[model samples]
Target: MDTMKRLGGDAFAPQTTYLNSASTGLIPAAGVAAMHEGVQATAAGRPLDHFRDVEAARAAFARLAGVPARQVATGASVAVYAGLIAASLPDGAEVLLSEDDFSSLVNPFHSRPGLKVRTVALEDLADSVRPGTDLVAFSQVQSADGRIAAVDAVREAARAHGARTLVDASQSAGWLPLPQADFLVAVGFKWLMGPRGITYLVVPEDLGGLTPLLAGWVAGEQPWDSCYGPVAELAHSARRFDISPSLYSYAGAVAGFELLDHLGIAAVRAHDAALADRFRAGLAELGHTPVHAPGSAIVSVPGLGARQPQLSAAGIEVSDRAGNLRASFHLYNSSDDVDRLLHSLT
Candidate 1:
């Protein structure tokens, strides 16, 4: 298929101008068809090996993340993986986090008693890493305003200080090239163009010192054999961290992953960023100064959040986050969508 047909022009048909991928991505036609097939199979009581879909999706995500399939753990939420990491930390271990990171990423550490959790400004996060900091955790992209973290700088800082790094790639995964970290977690619903209820965690080859807190039959060396009893042997790889698969969601995820694999992340990134840059230029022409996040696919205009409802009512999909009118572009979006939004704001 051609780029336009494969990416968005033909794969998606949104009634509204969808500029809210940061909120939730629109699953492509292939994903929707796969989901429909899954539902139909379930309704008909057909026997299908959904676990095959799970592993396929897992390997697909691993390819995007530049990791081996053995290092990826499939689950339903990023927070569950975050909690596992939290549970493995020793008491009073000092952790550094961004003040405004998504709560799922930050709250898990807080729930662990006796852990010292320190929050700092996003720009100051790398510098805040001190010798005693045991772990540094933050999102690769700020969900509120789409600020890309200085990942290389922060990772280098953590390495200098002997602090392990955890990055939440939920908002950045589909359109951004993920950096290596001790742990990385992402959900498929937002940018991977997959259904909700599927998330992934990339752990180090040694599993990043995390306990499989939510391990179930799926985490077994032989999942079917491990069911109805204690797992005789846990998976030797990161599969040990897997939660029971959500079969239907995994079906859709497999399709979404296939779509992304065919399109390629670098191509998607360039497409998304270009549209975002177009919107920024349009916003500038309209005399609106957006939040300073150069080269991000998400554009947030300060003090214009109140217009979100107005835009929505006018058939433009966007988000009002932390008092900013946030618009996120994706592989499926185009210059026309950017102009439509700009025209509405005018």
Candidate 2:
């Protein structure tokens, strides 16, 4: 099967090969068209009619994330972090997290008074859980080193310690399997091939003891009621975190989700894993060491002193993040791109 045709024409243009899907995916033409249509719909003064597509986007996101539509909210990953942290913790409660966790997930708890924050190294995760830890927050895949944590083990540990689990799937979603957790947050931009400003917060249906700190108009049960009235009951799922809707982002997400559905996530995952393996093999032949061996779709090859510019001059578009030459592969990337990158490195 030709993967290039599956990625659409926009992804095939020979200007610059995008091996940075871990950073920000290249928006396909279908996504662009969806965004344009969303704008046009709003400009026509029929915003009410746009709700269908908005709901469809929500449902598509939920389906892709393997959760119910109500359990999926659309927002930035930071917003999801804020909502999840606020809804899952109480005053004076401590939330245990890794020292290398994303700053967005840590900042909210750090800003609150009486909220204790503990940071542990990933190597000490099995022994890190304590009795007083209210929530254990970590990422399924570490963005920096591409190290995949044993999420099931962490979840079980957290459960044994009477703590909830919050997972950051920003670097893992759409490319890896959804690990079991109490709550999971994923951004659409990175691996989902969607536009930015959209993310999903998955909350289990049976767990509901905390209240959201930043509830807004769309969060209440009767969101259309008078602005000055009593706060209605919050929704049972992640929609309680929806402060407001971004119709344009929703449309773009719908297109992205459709593309993924067409290609089939299982196939995409297999193709990406193969590509990462190929890239890693090539990088090894060139005497470069990979950060964590290609675990997911992301492969990080550490370059020797100041070799990035030379590699770029040879027509490889790689990112230098934290002193590592990160070469990310997606379904759109072919074996030829890997060969070209290897040729450049040598």
Clashes of each: 0, 0
Per-residue C-alpha lDDT of model 1 across residues 1-346, encoded as one tens digit per residue? 3322225557887888888999899888877887788788888999577788888999999998899999999998988888889899999899999988999899999999989999999999989999999999999999999999999999999999999999999999899998899899999899998888998999999888787777888899988898887788899999999988788788777766776777788888888888888888888899999989998989999999999999999999999999999999987777778888999989
For residue 267, model 1's alpha carbon misses the true position, in angstroms, by 1.4
lDDT (0 to 1) per candidate: 0.88, 0.72
Model 2 Cα lDDT, one tens digit per residue, 151-173: 88888888899988888888877
TM-score of 1: 0.97
TM-score, every prediction: 0.97, 0.89
Regions more than 4 Å wrong, model 2: 2-14, 44-48, 83-88, 226-230, 303-315
- In Å, residue 81's CA in model 2 sits off its true spot by 2.6
Worst 10 residues of 2 by lDDT: 3-12
